[model samples]
Target: MDFYLAAVLQGLCFSGLALGIYLSMKIFNIPDITTDGSYTLGGTVTGIMLAAHIPQGFILPAVLLSGGVAGGITGFIHTKLRINALLAGILVMTALYSVNLTLMGRSNLPLLAFANLFGNWALTGSQGPDSLIVLLVITAALVFLLGYVLRTDFGIAMRATGNSESMVRALGVNTDRMKITGLAMANALTATSGYLVVQLQGFADINMGIGIVITGLGSVVIGETIIRRFRVVQPVSVLAILLAGAVLFQLALAVTLTLGIDPTLLKLVTALFVLLIVSLPRIFQSRTA
Candidate 1:
């Protein structure tokens, strides 16, 4: 039971990351690799603050704003300087590594003694349920706010721009600004995940974000597959589907580890899993053809 509960908690910790990837990859049709940097940036900031006995109240917003700035720089480079979007993300991600290292002053920081959202007495439950409840609140509130935002006029324009940039530009929407704003919002959410994760795991590492975007992408692909298979047509249902996908993804990982797979091979396994997810749709199309 504890093992399964831990898997669920892991999913909830990464829920924000899955949503961020959904925004950038599915909604914007861009593989915004800024996720790798922004995630660690959040963890680094939160870890540093808690170590200094700083107020926890400002940690999340600081992390979110830092992530937004990182993403905004990437967007500026891509839109204003005509750099390829992928390259722009890579550049920012590389630069953020240095920034994160500088802030952390080391490769990792332990938060086991830190006062955190899930560690307080206000939760009124055991550690497992308490963690799950807090994460659920954050996830649910984010999904609600995201649904509201996506239903607004500007959000519609953002989606339209993603669907057809030329059409949206002709319709007088500033596609560049939309892209920039979307990237900022996406990274902010990604950073929020990082903040949650460092708190849950009791440690923050510089390498925590390494290859992490793949996990987010896999969760997203899994979510999309479920939504399509079930014919879930509501825009809001996507959020629920994503939450479920993250849980299932973590469960799958737990199963692999339980099966005695070498821990060192986990990254390779993830890569293959992501490859399978990416190609399954194409394979299905070919079979139907």
Candidate 2:
């Protein structure tokens, strides 16, 4: 596959991760670092199930629930134990490394010949971009579903809890409950991305989730820039931009690779991209002021 096309497909796979970050960081105002662990957990579960010949459809719920549990643990520690949110996430993430290894029974699992969601089937093809098309459709559907959910009364309460915990609680909402729910949902979505990535890449590695949060953050930053420029605050608008940001970030990496850049510098480049994303808003605001 062409680098550009592959990048687009790659973007679609990671789009869910971006949405997860947006939910935890931007919406819930929590930096649930459990993302790193839950992501690997998802891939671990998926690889194990697929390699074992489990029906593909039956495995997704397991993947989601696994991530939710990881997130819930983080939320529990943060809310009940009063640990710092970052520390809570770190604790869970650290534990999950061992948990993931136990689940996989090793450091790596290969699905090279396993039938996957992106593999040839009666309804789907195995040609180039087939996975991309599958992922694109799923990603679009998720965006719409997420947009609809965010516009609901419960969703408004969730959003409110993020914006102002006191205000929401005064209105009879359970702030702690909302935070737990939000974090679980965020990590569940993130795990779904891992599920897709492992299948697409044909293997699951114990270290795959390391620093993945940075990639997701970069995508969210890119999306935020577009929204800030247009001043659109709608949930649907945010979702659209996030998806676009994921694609753009992937495309940038693909372009760099195509230009013959050393793969070793990719991490450095990613860090610089994130720095730019973080700084650009402040830079623009200062100039305008």
Candidate 3:
């Protein structure tokens, strides 16, 4: 039970990552691989700030700004230079690795000695349940904020840019600016996940973000499956479903671990699981056809 509970907590921590991916892939129609770099950049920023005894308030903004800048660079490359979106993300992600290393001054930064975001809370006297409450609130707030954004006129324009770029461009909208801003916002959220996770895990490792985008993609895929199956249309409800999907994905991994699968095979399991989810609908469609 505790193990599964921890999984739920981890899922919540990754909610921001999942949301970022949703915005980039589903909303902006970009496969922004910059997630792999920006996530670690977030953790790196958090670790540095926390280790220096910096206030949490300042740390959060710094993390968001760093991630946003990284994403914006990718967006600019894609839009202005006419580079492929995927390749632009790759270039920025590659550059962020060296940046993160230089900023951290080391490959790993231990943060267990400091008072973390969750370490100070004693609501339940058990960090796991207490942390769960904090994460739930944070996740809910994020969902609400994003839901509201998606409903605004600006958000409609952003969505239009994704759904019908040519039409929106014809309507005198700056589609390039929209893409840049959208990617920036998405990566800022992704960085927030890094901030949350670094504190939760008590350390920040340079390689922590490696393949992290896949986890986000898997969560999005699961949520998308649920959305399609139920035909969910409400923006707020859709965001909530994605959050739940993140939790479910973590639970699935927990079950796998409990079954005694070698820890070394975890990534492989994740890949296979995501593949299965992605392929299922097509399989059913084929059979019906």
Q: What are the runs in model 2 whose C-alpha is more than 4 Å off?
A: 121-126
Model 2 quality (TM-score): 0.96
Give the TM-score comparing model 1 with the true structure, all chains together: 0.97
After superposition, the stretches of candidate 1 with alpha carbons farther than 4 Å from their true spots are: 122-124
Cα lDDT tens digits for candidate 1, 222-282:
9999998998866678887997898888888889889899989999988888899879899
How many angstroms is residue 286 displaced in model 1 relative to the true structure, after the best TM-score fit? 1.4
Every model's TM-score: 0.97, 0.96, 0.99
Q: Model 2 over residues 14-101: C-alpha lDDT tens digits?
A: 9889999999999989988999999999999999999899997788999999999999889999999999999999999999999999
Which residue runs of candidate 3 sit more than 4 Å off their true CA positions? Answer: none
- Candidate 2 lDDT for residue 219: 92
RMSD of each: 1.2, 1.5, 0.7
Query: Against the true structure, whose lDDT is highest?
Result: 3
